[model samples]
Target: MIQTDGAFGRPTRHAPPLLNARHAEDYWQQATRCIDLVRRKMASVDRPFTGAHPEELKRLFEGIDLDAPLGELRPALEELERVYLDDAVYFHHPRYVAHLNCPIVLPGILAEAILAPINSSLDTFDQSAGGTFIEQSLIDWTANRIGLGQDADGVFTSGGTQSNLMALMIARDHYGAALADHGDNKHEGLPADYRRLRILGSEVSHFSLQKSAAILGLGYQAVMPVACDDHFRMDPAALKARLEECLAMSLIPIAVVATAGTTDFGSIDPLEEIAALCRAHGIWLHVDAAYGGGLLCSRRYRHRLAGIEHADSVTVDYHKTFFQPVSCSAFLVRRRSDLRHVTHHADYLNPLCQAEAGTPDQVNKSLQTTKRFDALKLWLTLRIMGADALGEMFERVIDLAGEAHDELARHPAFEVLLDPPMSTLVFRYRPADLCETELDELNAYVRAALSRNGEAVIAATRVDDKRYLKFTLLNPDTRLEDLTAIVERIVHHGRAWCEAQAPTRAAAS
Candidate 1:
């Protein structure tokens, strides 16, 4: 409770005020204690997760009052440790190979500590003077690395989804204006023929493109899915045929979205070929390299994204492959002028006069007004670990995936899919006696069983209507032996499920 009758009418609260000199020690001590608890928890990474059920979690949290304080910091942190930290999924653990979540580097963690206390918003220059420059510098560095031209500019976004959204939004407005006799879509509504506008992408491209179309008022129907080859990469010839068909039908092509790294198979599309097609069609090319953009620094695998420089815009999520924490991603454009489509100046935040006077405000280029200082995390990471060191870590994980792929291929019970283009391996359990339907059920059962036991964590996806298991190797510490053991555990669960099903099948028959 706050007492309003204090000196100078300042409220006297149970919690210390931000600049209260008397309670400074108390604040420092409590923060240090929390940090210590985190360090201990991180060090003890024996289990990937506690496998807490939904009902159990609901029971544990149901009694807590959101508005009420728990009192002392020690008791509060202890309660958090018991109810949240203990049961939370540990991505740093070697067995946790389920998603694109990467084990964060030390410097990134340190940056979080620093940024949280300061609480600087990177939106306006007045709010974050040096912060704006730092973020812009990081974006410029990333743009240069991508080989985007001198006019390349970008803004840090919350994640890849937002970046993808911004990219499509820019593309839509750019082409829509041309179609509407150079009218502004922001001032005037989308052209009357917006229904015929279409964006092209591979069938395996991220679903964000479809969502972007819907958000842009183009409707989800406006997205045209191109065919992918056997390797799960976009087929250039098929894309060409589709473009020709669209032209014949008088459908306007807005943008061509190419996936540099798809989620399930980690496949890299034919970027150079796709760029050529987009160039010929005079359409905007946006590459969603959220998962594969880290390869820009990878000494050994940089050639995989050879034609990314030709992209009109690109989305890169550092959290996915650059060993950074979540919410660190950027939307980069080849020409800085393209971003003006999304810029709307407000009198209060970033006035048009201020921008014209050469003031650099981040909100002018971002969809978000109050943005986090996420670039600091990447800055600290680069300074401490170096780009080459990060690249080597990525290389290790990619190599581990190859080794795991080979092991799965040689194993008698497992059927390995295509060799990984990056660091994801898709495979499934297959017994000689069981049919395809039974095998699918067995593999799904195996995944559930492993998840329930909390021994290992992996992912599952469907390819060509068939269920398959996936191991997304983003943890650099995860070794070939650990992957092999996880595969063995999966096999064990699969065999047990198959045996249990045999008697039931016989009875049914």
Candidate 2:
């Protein structure tokens, strides 16, 4: 016979009531202590990368015995809590501007903490009944945004990288269906008529396309990068010339990748021109709108991504511009049938007939068998905030970027590179008397020093081989003050570094 504690039964020895009483008391005490620690840690404002009391961690795990008793475990756990609680960079703090990651909404974070551990996997209906439906709903919602009609299909991928890979997979299979039947002679030996597959994109297209090329059995050499115009948009004439060259070389131009918004400068490529070129060439057109897709929400800025509707497929990373947390990304296709190219059969899992019937099996449409229902966060965000609210948020950020451009230009010590086409402003830290080389080095040093000191987080990139600092204003919480403050710090630090180098330059001279 098992004795219970009025809740559930644990395997017990023939121990006395006092022993169990001590165990329950000990658990409550440790839990209360942990809760208090959490509360205090969150309430503190320093946002320290390392906690104040690092040495106290040594005592945390030293005296604990796991097998002794539940009562005996409290002291050890208290130590464990002390060691690991408050040593992370607080992204929620307004200064975190390094990458495209967004500060998560409070409700979304709460939903993730609760639902993630409960309904863990979204691979099949049995494992994630409601979760599968929710993910599908989000996919359908995104498809509608692309004007894909009822026959459209999409899948939530890990991020922009995986989405680009999936797009390549669909394009490759659609162009090379013979490989599905015979596993491709190249897998065993090169075929006599093996023609190189070519992909064309602006030089500023995301590096993910190169990675996608490598993964799709096409070498990086196979991906041809066409030149972009002065504003970094792809030039259709350049792309047409490259396509003509590829044709003359007898290379199969498999896909044309257009950038709706580039990574470095947020420069939108000539999408309408590229789309028309792709149609003329009978090539698959994929618009990599990962950064610019959020412009879909803004009527004022939507014209920037014109001809996106003509894309055979498009990739969108909601985390970058939509302010959705990371991994809420997808690839949208013009036709649902294109996804059939990535389909496969497993005897134990999705059988032939079930997939053929299209019973809403996400695995059939994805490269990943076991996927996360990352779409829930987006769904919940939309349901609560509505599309207009998110769109307005995007517009506000773009508006702020414009303001930043004007202000940075007005500052005597700074040189704003170009008008922020989207939300990214690329600029150099130009001091009053610094030469070209000195100014460039000073700016670079400032960026490195700020990142090292953890005072602020900003991005650095190269355009035409010259390094420039970039501000990607993805966070709606980030204000004009935040941008100006960081720019001021960069100027101050850059000037200091340049002054310090003056004596060295004189000595060398």
Tell me each candidate's TM-score: 0.96, 0.85
Report lDDT (CA) for all predictions: 0.89, 0.76
- Give the per-residue Cα lDDT of candidate 1 at 292: 97
As for model 1, its CA RMSD to the true structure in angstroms is 2.7
Question: In candidate 2, what are the lDDT values of residues 422-489, reduced to their tens digit?
Answer: 88888888767667777678778998777666567787887777778888777777798988788878
TM-score, candidate 2, is 0.85
Give me the runs in candidate 1 sitting further than 4 Å from their true place. 1-11, 14-16, 19-23, 180-182
What C-alpha lDDT does candidate 2 achieve relative to the native structure?
A: 0.76
Q: Write the per-residue lDDT of candidate 1 for residues 1-509, one digit (tens) a residue.
A: 66432222233556344535655565577678888999999898687977778888778887789787654566678889988998899999999999899999999989998887788999999998898999999999999999998999999999989999999999989986776375778988888888999999999899898888999998899999999999999999999999999999999888999999999989999999999999999999999999999998899999999999999999999998899988799999999999999899999999999999999999999999999999999999998889999899999999999999888899888898899999999999887888778888988998888878888888999988899999999999999888878888887887788788889989978
